[model samples]
Target chain A: MAYKCYKLESILTINNLTKKFGYLTAVKDLSFTIKKGNVYGILGPNGSGKSTTLGVVLNVVNKTSGDFHWFDGKISTHDALKKVGAIIERPNFYPYMSGYQNLKLVCKIKGVNYSKIEEKLKIVGLLERKDSKFKTFSLGMKQRLAIASALLNDPEILILDEPTNGLDPQGIHQIREIIKQIAAKGTTILLASHLLDEVEKVCTHVVVLRKGKKLYSGRVDEMISSNGFFELKCNNQEALVTLLERHNSFSKIKVENDLVTAFLTEPMRSDDFNKYLFEKGIILTHLIQRKESLEEQFLQLTDNQTNQI
Target chain B: MLRLLNIEYYKLKYNKASRVLIIIYFALLSLMSLFATIKFNIGPIKFHLAELGIFNFPYIWHFNTFVASLLKFFLLLVIVSMVANEYSNKTIKQNLIDGLSKKEFILSKFYCVIALSLISTFFVFVVSLILGFIYSSYTELTIVFSDLEFLIAFFVKLLGFFSFGLFLGMLIKRSAFAVAAMVVLFLIEIISYGIVCGINKGTELADRIYQFLPFKSLWNLIDEPGSRLSAVKEVAAQIGEDLSYDYSVRWYEIAIVLAWTALFIFLSYRLLKKRDL
Candidate 1:
């Protein structure tokens, strides 16, 4: 797919922000910028201040120190917020009210005229159940309604926390489609979730945190090396292990039962080794290059709990 | 402000607790009215303690009576239920995060409470007017035109109770606490009145406290021969002839109620705005 780059202007900027809850610091001096039209993902473990950071940025929770600016051609938050919509926590709707009525409430608060409620319902694909009481919605449908409510203002930005909390695979696919649809319309998205796989798919850039501090923040593909690694499968694993042990050309060597893995110092080095093994009458079943996954990058950056804030 | 009011109005119209309260209120009022009609044989009797039940209902059968006697208690229930529902359901924290300003959200609640109270009071007044006509066999008994003096007194009493209920909800955002405080307020006043009359021979400090308490002041709005001031006088005379209980509604009490409401709202708003959602 051909990529269309946004102008790359900063839409959200945070500097030296902190939030303290009595004895514990919820967010510890975090700083980062989210550029316009970028799908920025915030990744963190449980209680790692992901929610706290969002709460402070959205002005729902007061920060103990530091400042943030929404530089999308607006001065104050009310103006900026007029162009922004958010769902900071779980889906909230009056249980007695129908899904449409709940969205109407959000519309009133957001001060946006939404004559076509069905359009939003269509966007989330909940049009058939718009009349259902909010309490009757499954967690996934409730989340869709929450997203629909945030979309009411036709906002330029959407801030969501754990947007797909409880969902089956199909529901997750549905939500992913809806998010991509919104993004296709040029709405910048700021999403927080512990699901690295989801972030890897939807986000352009990501920020990872551990114990209230920023561990890593950059372009997603760059964060995970796009370069390849060798994946070798062999019949004579003992002979291959002996050969690898004699040569110190790699790091992170591991032998698990019948399989052994060793990182290569150069690409195609595995091909030369395979040829030598073949000459020795050792059959190689599988030999392919493997790219790093987001999970691996996450574990690498946040290696230990002690290193966390 | 108007937008906030609209939101509150919409929520109340759709809230289940509000709906249940309305249904229960009319059910109780009809049973009381039916019992009174059968006992008096007047179809719409003017004044019968048997029909009157607990709260004061003088020579009237308007909406105010239905509201004063039935809906007032139900209104308190609404406030308690509304706050409690938020906590029990874990929605208050969610609403705050959804972009409602702290002041706007709290004000929406108070707005709903006041609107419901006024609506209930008006509904009672209207029902009484209708009953007045039905009993007299005259279709044209105009709605009673209350004078400024009566209306002011009624407003003061109504606002005092309304504010008290609001304070209770704020202090105990949890449903159980809110409901308990409301029940206690009502029970303490009812029990104190009985104790002063029967046990203490009307000479105890409890009698004096009962006379000045906010809940008891609600009776002052009724057009009775024994003014609440007189009730205060009865208690004050117990100590000395020169002093009376000061039964008349005082501005200071209104100030105190307003202050209490403000304090509760401020504290709750602070917690809402500062705490993690």
Candidate 2:
């Protein structure tokens, strides 16, 4: 038999989704899209609507207004959601049930075969504790079991909200490694987290949010690779600022604590800028070139947003 | 329907509280058979409780069902907590994310209620048969099978009560508060009966109105079999009391309780549908 195979680029799309808690808007007109094979990160601080957005899409939290759909502009039906595994906030299960029992229930709901339960449990490293009750498992084991349950059907897109919120360093590392392996198998992932470094290590695209608003959304590299300001100290900081202020390459220049930090307007290598400064007769005792860190960019975005409010 | 019930089965099977309550409920149901062995004497009133024709054909059905229906409270705890745990553990939200729709979740609980009712009804049927064979003098098949509506009424009563518990669990979202709310509602019915009968100085109007109350209507399904016993008749005769109450199952009362069962399940579904988990 011959059949047609449809290729959908956008695995999940949200258009102006908004959720309100009476007087408080948990998520406000938020919109983003997750394409196939993209490890998307929803980067935000606490109470910034990261979980709320994921909740609305997963249909756990009802949206006050707006729309979201999965798989090629179609409305999110059970079939579409069955192929999208998700865990919102913390891992929730029947506390009295074992890890295997919890996954068995999940498999029943997702209509997956029971044989996959052990395989998924092994993936999360819960095979050793499969018979232990959920209440008996530590928080880390509970999270790993949740991830196993989510992967029972081999979902096309995995949505995780604060998956590593409360774990020790090793536990966090283990969770990240599991996520990395899942993504390596070519499954699209949408991860929401308040940890900047976690997103830096796992995500390919990012949407930065603050106070229920989107501050930035683009490739992680683009957000980090923007025209970054530099920090340099020389004997004559005043001369460096004055000489560089007239040049077409530098847009913004500031002098603080006997140091000069300049933002480049046009694309120019650090070596070229240092050459220009050297030719201007300003010798440098300290020459430091720094690219914008995700932390700095995230802080600047949220800070600017707070000041605007 | 099988899929939904299968899902509910795993959840209830693995829950420790549910397992304990289920065992206790069935144990209590089975313990009712020991009532046939009671033979004692109260001063000047020598009596073997089983010899009073209480276990006689037809009456055995009424007596057994009425007694067993009182034990439905145990399974009601199971149903209510089953819904309550979903909220407390937030598994309902996870279930939805795992692709179980809201409607399917409600159906799962409803199916559980139905299954519990059927199983308890079957258990009561079997226990009554054993008790009847041991104590009943009338051994005819027709007599034994005559008044089986009481069994059907028992099943309906359980279904209504457990559905009400499920609805309350969904509405209250806490096990203790949901059970407390059920008590409060029952108390409201009792107080209303008191006020209505007190104002009119008679039970004539109150009796007519009490038939509409859902909780009282469940009791109306199987009129108390205690008053029909010969021992009670002799005692009431000595006190010059009138023993003229209806002691048979009424169809309208069963209809009323069945209607309430559908309403409670629907309300439970609506509660889950509107709430943001």
Candidate 3:
């Protein structure tokens, strides 16, 4: 899908937000900005303040300190919320009511036209079962109905906290597809999930959180690209290590059990490294360039934070 | 406010418990009305409650208020369950997430309480009017409208009591617990009243202060009629004349009920605003 550039606008801005439950701090002084049309992901493990942050911003949980603005302060919090749809923690609805009835109630609360209910239900692939009671639905179906309710307002921004949680592979795939489709329609999304793979698959930008603190925030590709590494193996491992040590392009080299791993300091083709090593009489048996996965980066970041503390 | 009311109405209509509660309320109300209209003979005297000035134009107001007040427990149970179920189901959180302000959410329930009170009072008015026309001996318009204040008293008492129920529901956040707490609260108040009376040695000043208690204030809205039994008619007449305070709704009692209603609503709102859903 082609990206639409609507003049860069701040969709949501949270500053110095903190939430405390008695002496336990669920969300520390945290802040982030989400621009329009960006699929901003709050990536963290469970109890890492992802849901609490979403709750505070959505005005469902009162903040202990600081403030947040939605739609660039064009409206009050309640008024701004009308233009936003969200599902935090889990799919919560009137269980006794049918999917259609639940969505109707959402529309009523949102003060939106009911014409879009069917369209949203269709988008979530729940149109056929719209008449089924919420309690009768499978967890996946319940999650789909939640997404449908979130889309009923045709909101400008959607905030989903663990949207794909408790879903099977197929259910996760369907939810991700639905989210991508919604994003393509120019709806900014703020997703919170502990699943690093889900965040990597769906988010354009991510904010890594640990113990209620932000560890990193930037574009997903940049985060992975900056930490790219290469793994190499050869028949003469000792000679290969000595040769790579002489090269300034490779940094942080480590050799373990005939395997060599090192980060590339600058963008260089693997074929050039192979040729350079071949000139040194070291035959290149294997040369593999590996881009860091979000999971690895998340672990490293959180681990480093833990070590520092 | 209207939008909130509409939303609450939709919610209540879809809830089976609420529907059942309303049905039960009406059924019990009709049964009590029937019981009142039946005639019975005791010893040498043959007397029916309906004929003992109860269905008479002026006294119909008191009779209806007393009967309707007996059914207020059903409304209280419904309100308690409705409020507590929101917490149990986490639908209140969804409602807030769906763009409703905390104030709006509480106000919606408040609107439901008012609606219930008004509906209950309307039924009382209609039933009493019908029974009064059929059983009343007097035909004057003035007599028919003599004690209309009792209707206002009934409405106030229902609103006050239901708001208290709302408060209990919000405070407990569990249907069964809130209902149980309400029953316990009644026992506590009654027992406390007894203790206070004993301590004060049944002085008039103590009795006057006791009437101002929250539950006592609401119950005092409609005084029990004294002319029901022929045996006690003369003594009842003497007591009624001596007290002069026992038969009519007082301005202070209305103020007290209204005050308690406001306090309950305020506390419920504060609880919603301050708590994390």
Candidate 4:
């Protein structure tokens, strides 16, 4: 498939968006911007307003306050939505109708040509069962059909909420592959998920939300690579801890399960540390430098945010 | 508008409940006409016209209109199911997400109501025409087409009732509850009319005001046929005298039904706009 080249421009801008259900605030004053051709992930724990934010932007749920503009104010919400495809919360369709019929209905509503229906069904690996009723589809097949429906219009932007919520491992892999392929075609994809690994694997950019408040938003690589740490296990654990505690080169050294881990206080290489340990007569067995995983960063960020409150 | 109607037609085309309900409605409608053609005798008296008046020229319009209006329940059931299924299946939310405006969604349903009404009315018109030709004494076009106002009246009455059913479905958002609410509303309107009539006693103004109620206004569209058997006419006349209100179709009654239809459409639109899917 040929990829479309889109200009580097802001695709969506939301400012101080808040949604309140009576006394309970589902989404606080939230704001974010999505750029063209980037797979942006709204990452959060359950009930962190990930789905609500997507719903508000999609115009399915009315915002209580605040506003959002699509395409940097070039078009109204309705017009902007025409270029976007979305599936909010669940894959809802007419259960009694065949998948082909359901996609045809979507095409009718979106005013898109029905010619792409067969192609989309083939892309999702559901072309074989396209004639089957939605009620008879497995959960994985249902989710696949939903992606097909979203792709029916060849939308410039795709919004998905928990697209792989209840799928088995094989189902999850298929969905992830489909999403990557779509994103590879230069379509800006905005997806919400509570799965940390999914965001780390699929998202180029991420916004970490906790309890309807944004804790951090930036590139995923930048978030994970900011704090680099080293894990080391020596033949003598006591000597390794003492040596690291005395040296000013390393900070926050801690011993766990016969392994000493610490952050680099300054720019240094693992080779220098190994040489230092060899010089001190401390025979080394294992020394590895590792970047922080998104799960750890997410937990630390959310815990810190809670402690500040 | 045509596109929206086409979309609704596609949705209904595959719906089993809609298909079965429509089939049952037509079957029952045919049976009602069949019953109107049968003849029976009670000892020394005859009761064939009770079964034969529906086929007579000119009077056939009034007779068929009354019978068709009684089958409005089928239309109501179809409308309620169509509207309520959107909510239960969460398809309404999907429709909105697919870029359909709230107004378009409501208008699509109104189109469905109109289509259903028109189709059923056409059936009644065709059946009446066939029966009138086969059994009436006169063959002149004027004699067969006289009192055609009842046909128009019947169409409007179906539109009014079906639109009202759509409103109730929107309000209730549940098929079973909405249908039950329709029955309850009918009973409430009838009871309220009775209470008002009883309190006013012999006041003509109060009796006139009672005819303007939602369901009652629709009922007043086609007045009871006055050319029934003498015994039946006597009983109807006695009841009419006690109520102190005429069952004649009035111009304002048709106007009232049109107004109610507009009101229901407006309320349905308002409800869809204000409420989150």
Candidate 5:
């Protein structure tokens, strides 16, 4: 998919946010910004302050200390949550009320035009099931209604904490597509999830938090490519290992089954290694530079915090 | 604010609870009125009984009869379910998160309860007016405007009781607790009335304490002026007849009700604003 080039502007700015729950520090001095129309993410293991960070930003939960600004400082959530719609944890609804009625309640509170509600329901593809009681909805359907509820006012900033948590594979894909469509129209989305693959596919920017502290915050691509590795799949692993061993530039190697994976501090030396290996009669079935998986990079960054990794 | 009201009204109109509540309440009142018409025979005196707006039925308009028979219990149930459903369904929290100012959140409920109470009371008022016409035609009884005065009295009574429900919603943001407390308070008020007036029949101290029964003040508002049950007489007796003539439509009572309503609303608002879902 061709990505839309966005004019980079910080839509959400968090300055030194920290929150404490009793004696436990839930979010520790976390700071990051989500650029305009950016699909920003917070990726961490469970209990890693991901949800807490979103909670603080949305003002559903209190912050011990911090500040957040929205829309390039035109408005901040402090008094401007009117423009922000969010769902922090499980989608909560009046079980006895129909999905349409529940979203109506959200619209009532947000003071939005009621006609916009049908538009949101259609966007989330819940128009057909809008009249069903919330209790009767499947978990995925309930989530869609929840997303529809969040979009009731057509908020400029949509913050969803684990939007796909209870969705099936198809449901997850549907939600992802809906989010992408919304973001494509220039709505900023802030998502928090532990699903590395999902984050890798969706997030343009990411802030990796480990045990209440930010370990990485920047463009998602940069974080993944900061430390590159060599993924080598060869017909002759023994010959390939011998050729790579001849070079002191690479730092670590692991052989699994018939493939040899190596990490190199200096990825520039790979061309020279390829030439040497070619001359030595080792067939390079595959020689590809590997960007670290979000999972691997998360593990590496948060490994210092014993509990978080 | 009007939009909020319209949206809230639509929500209530579509809800099963609202429709069911009106039907069940009207039915319950009808059943109670039927029982009174059939079982209680006052010598040679006829009564017009209206069940759920059925006119010229059998029994005369009796707010006390309805209060004693069913209105109190029905009101308690309605109030409890209305507030409790919000908590159980998590809609209240969602409302706050959706951008309602804490005050609007609480005010919306207060206004809803008031609207429901007025609706219920209006039905009763219509019944009373029809009963007055029937009583005037069939019996020696002459229906007076004083009877109409009861409507105003009912309005004030609705305010107090509605605020009572709001208080319950605030004190216990849980459905079980709010509903239970409402039930318990209903019983306590009824029992206390029996204890102070019936069992302890003639004691002066008991009579004085009866003056302070929270619900007694409400009932007194509707009672005939010179009757022993009249709250007006009770107030007059306490501070002399001179004060009674000076007092027109107990501003003090209205003030007290307003104060209670404001206090409970503020408390509910403060709690909602400060507490985490």
Candidate 6:
């Protein structure tokens, strides 16, 4: 098989990793593998345990059962963590310390040189603000400084959780650019984000999670259910959703807000879908055949949520 | 180990509050010399603190250390607040993620505690030597260095007390609560000792039992040196008082406090290791 022709070294491997808070399972039986240079995206909704899974692997949050390995060991080695750079949750830093001092602290931890601090800070455009206290920076700048800190060790793998969250559009754009620049250099990255566009824009492979359960995990291309999915809107969106769910023409369908996106089971056209809906006493107010991978991935998630719920 | 201490050094170096508290603590430790110049005359009699032989070596070692040990709460507050800052800033989690093992983190804190205790001990040693040379009548080299064990006892006392602060900081994760917990623990020991004494009708059983308690062991490191003053002894002798008390720093007391310091450090490590961050 072509798959067996090449062997990739696994950088991180999680097996049946689970975390429970009281009775609530933040992540359950979650398993995945990232070989060298894999831009893995953990895609999910807001409360879908994306951060929890990353937290478990990082050893900042304890697991309820199962284990994960970095490099070759079953348990996390401090040396292995030293090789990997990560930013969990917010951009945690000492507010009174300057950007330089905070990064200096990380250098001490990772056993890196102080000179490397200037180089990495320059990469994120934080060199000029290196003397400023961390609390004085804007949220965007804080996120960028975190990225700089993460890159100081020349990390083997970078794990970022919701990196662009709570940022303006321009801030999001700059962060994405930095991530892309790093990914372009063939650095392995495990990005956990709830934004579908973020995963679709940057991730090569994605693991879809919802409410602590893994719904899908594969390449970005394979996540698409069919060639494309159809999106339709009608005045009576309630009746339209019910009619579409009852119809057998599409493999999967869901209503989010006012529009309903339906995945084609047998490759159907938008006109045919509209005509079928029209004959059933429903008139289409808006129709679109979204061929973009974003819609296909988005519908896949919402469809799973609708099915599971 | 030096690397860990270096990390903690920079952490406290940048913190404004810790810096201020440290300055105040050292200043107060040195300011203890001001008591020597406090001489006043009323009518035909003159009373002078330095004339009381408080600075008489080797008794100066005991006197200075006890007075200096009283100021340790300032540095204890600094240590507690530093730990609480780590939590409030969520930097503790970041430190773990950045590759510091939980054991290393706890070791860094322990090293900082040791450093604070050692520096305070050295500072007090220098200040006492200066004050003794000016006021103590026995300036012989042998007399000057004879009872320096009080400096060692002072180090152990501060080490144990600050380790307790570090443990409470980790256990509570809030500076105010950690301080409150220290006060509450002190009260518990005092109240329990009182009850034990009241029930036994004397301090025989109570002293025997409470000797092993953390604070009791700390207080025992340097028994109060006030009664050892020549003036106090002369007055007591004239008043038909025996004035027979153990004024020496005992090894058992130092060993017990060292044990408590080790226990507090172990508990702090356990808390750090078991916590989820």
Q: Of the candidates numbered 2 and 5, which has the greater TM-score value?
A: 2
Best by TM-score: 2
TM-scores of all candidate predictions against the true structure: 0.79, 0.95, 0.94, 0.93, 0.78, 0.91
TM-score of chain A of each: 0.88, 0.91, 0.94, 0.94, 0.86, 0.81
- Which lDDT values do the candidates have, in the order given? 0.70, 0.88, 0.86, 0.86, 0.70, 0.89
Off by over 4 Å in 6: A1-5, A74-76, A230-263, A267-288, A292-309
Kindly list the per-residue Cα lDDT of model 4 for residues A9-94, writing each as its tens digit. Answer: 78899999999877989889999999988899999999999888887877777899999999878776766777788988778999
TM-score of candidate 4 restricted to chain B?
Answer: 0.90
DockQ values for all predictions? 0.32, 0.83, 0.79, 0.70, 0.38, 0.72
Question: Residue by residue across B1-277, what tens digits does model 4's lDDT show?
Answer: 9989999999988899888999998877766657555667789877775344557778778888898889889878989989999999899988888888878889999999999888888888888888778777776998887888888899999999999999999999998999999889899988877787778786365558867778888878987765453445667687784323454567888899999999999999888877766
Order candidates by lDDT, high to low: 6, 2, 3, 4, 5, 1
**Which segments of model 4 are wrong by more than 4 Å?**
A1-7, A72-74, A235-239, A246-251, B50-52, B202-206, B226-231, B234-248
If the candidates were sorted by their DockQ against the true structure, best first, what order would they fall in?
Answer: 2, 3, 6, 4, 5, 1
Question: Model 6 over residues B1-277: C-alpha lDDT tens digits?
Answer: 9999999999999999999999999999999999898899998989999888988889889999999999999999999998888998999999999999888988999999999999999999999999999999999998999988999999999999999999999999999999999999999999999999999899889988888998888888889988888788889999999887878888888888899999999998888777776
Model 3, runs deviating above 4 Å: A1-6, A255-258, B41-47, B226-231, B235-245
**Candidate 6 at A245: error in angstroms?**
13
Tell me the tens digit of each residue's lDDT in model 1 across A44-131. Answer: 9889999999878776778999988887535765456656778866787788889998888777777777685778989898999999
Q: What lDDT tens digits, residue by residue, belong to model 3 across residues A1-309?
A: 344465678889989889998999988889889998788899998999998898888888899998999977878888888899898777889888899998999999999898999999999999999898899999889888988898888888999989888899999888899888888887888889998887787789999998888888889888876547789988998888887888888787988887899887888887887788788898877789987788988898899899999
lDDT of 2 by residue, A1-309 (tens): 123224438888899988899999888888888788779999899999988888777877788999999887654466677888888878999988888888889988889999999899889998889998889998998889889988989999998989998999989999999999998998999999989888898889999988888888999998876577778889887788888889887778887788888887667777887887888898888777666779888997899889988
TM-score of candidate 6 chain A against the true chain A: 0.81
Candidate 5 stretches greater than 4 Å from native: A1-10, A72-79, A111-118, A231-248, A253-261, A269-271, A277-289, A307-309, B27-70, B136-143, B147-153, B185-254
Of the two candidates 3 and 4, the one with more favorable DockQ, higher being better, is 3
